[model samples]
Target: MKQFAMLIYPGFTALDLIGPQTVFSTFRDAKIHLVWKTLDPVTTDAGITLLPTASFDTCPEELEILFVPGGVEGTIAVMKDGEVLDFLAARAEQASYVTSVCTGSLVLGAAGLLRGYRATTHWAFREMLPLLGAEPVDARYVEDRNRITGGGVTSGIDFGLRIDAKLQGEEAAQLA
Candidate 1:
């Protein structure tokens, strides 16, 4: 199975997680892990709650992909979360791919993962990329080496499909 670790934190935007997850769900051989600091219920900025299926301590040692979803306040907080940022920096070294959607890029940047990489995020926050030493691009998603960052929430679907194509094949992505 292709293992995926998806970060879920308090106040994560629902669509940011769901959009990419929907695409990943199409693959029968995929293992999607909703990961958090602990296996607890995480509330979204939209007021909805999601139960985490795994914790950072329990997550696979290596992953096919490490994904982070985004929310404004949450992203801001995560940018300052030393623990989460440290975990991401460590895991990203072993994972095949490192990714984020919307302001999640800022968190990745905070983790020191985006330095000198070309990336993109929610349009409103695109200007912030340079602060992290990331080259801001205006595309819906930017792929630099193994790091990928998607635009706003709705763009996650496209990002997921693209990743599916990269890991599988065009035929698989088309089917998804």
Candidate 2:
């Protein structure tokens, strides 16, 4: 089974998390883990509450995909969080794909995962990418090496389908 880990924190955008997750769900025998620092419920920017399936310490050591979702206040806070960054960095080392949606790229950049990588994020935050050692691109999504980043919120579906095609196949992505 393919293991996918998605990071969740208070104030994350619901669409950012749900879009990709919906696509990932179509994968056969895949395990999607909603991970956080603890097994507590996280509230999204849209006022939706999501339950975490795994804590950072309990997440799989190896992952097929390591994903992060983005929001305004939450993204900023996560960028400055050492523990979350450390966990992301460690898991990313073994993940087949390291991905983000919207401002989630900023969080990955904070973990130093986007350095020297060509990436994309929400348009409003594009200028800030250079500061994180990433070359910002204006597109729905950008893929550099094993790193794939989606643009603004709704772009996550496109990003997820792109990844699905890469991991599965064009036919599978279309089916998804």
Candidate 3:
């Protein structure tokens, strides 16, 4: 069974996390781990809070996939956070694929994963992608090899479905 780690931070977008959560959790064979900075409930951008399944230090060593969700805080946090950036950069090397939703691309870019890669993010942050050395693709969802990125909050689902097809196969993804 494939194990996926969904990384969420305070002030993250609810749709960015829940959209993929709903889609991926339907697969009984796959284990989805919610990773956060702390175990305490963290509020989403929409005012909803979720209790994380694991903290950063407690996350499983081997993750087949990693999903990073974006929010207002992510725009600032992921940019200047060396701890988060190092954590992502290290794990991204071993994970089968690394992905982001909305401004989550900013996080990925800050981690140095988007260097020389064309990616997309929330329309609001589209112009800022160059700061991380990434080219903005301006698509709702952009897939470049092992990296998949989505635009804004709602686009996370489409990004998840695209990844589902790539990782699990068309039939499996369609079922999702």
In terms of TM-score, which candidate is strongest?
2
Query: Using TM-score as the measure, what is the rank order of every candidate, best first?
Result: 2, 1, 3
Candidate 2 or 3, higher TM-score? 2
Specify the poorest-scoring 10-residue window by lDDT in model 3: 72-81
lDDT by residue for model 1 over 1-176, one digit each (tens)?
Answer: 98899999998899999999998998878799999999879999999999999888898878999999989888888889888998899889899999999898989999999999999999999999999989999988999999999999999999999998998899999998
* lDDT string, candidate 3, 105-172, tens digits: 89999899998888999998899889898989989999787888899989888888887787778898
Candidate 2: give its CA RMSD in angstroms: 0.5
Model 1 weakest 10-residue run by lDDT = 73-82
State model 3's lDDT: 0.85
TM-score of each: 0.98, 0.99, 0.93
Q: Spell out the clash pairs found in candidate 1.
A: none
- Which pairs in model 2 have colliding backbones? none
In candidate 1, residue 31 scores what lDDT? 96
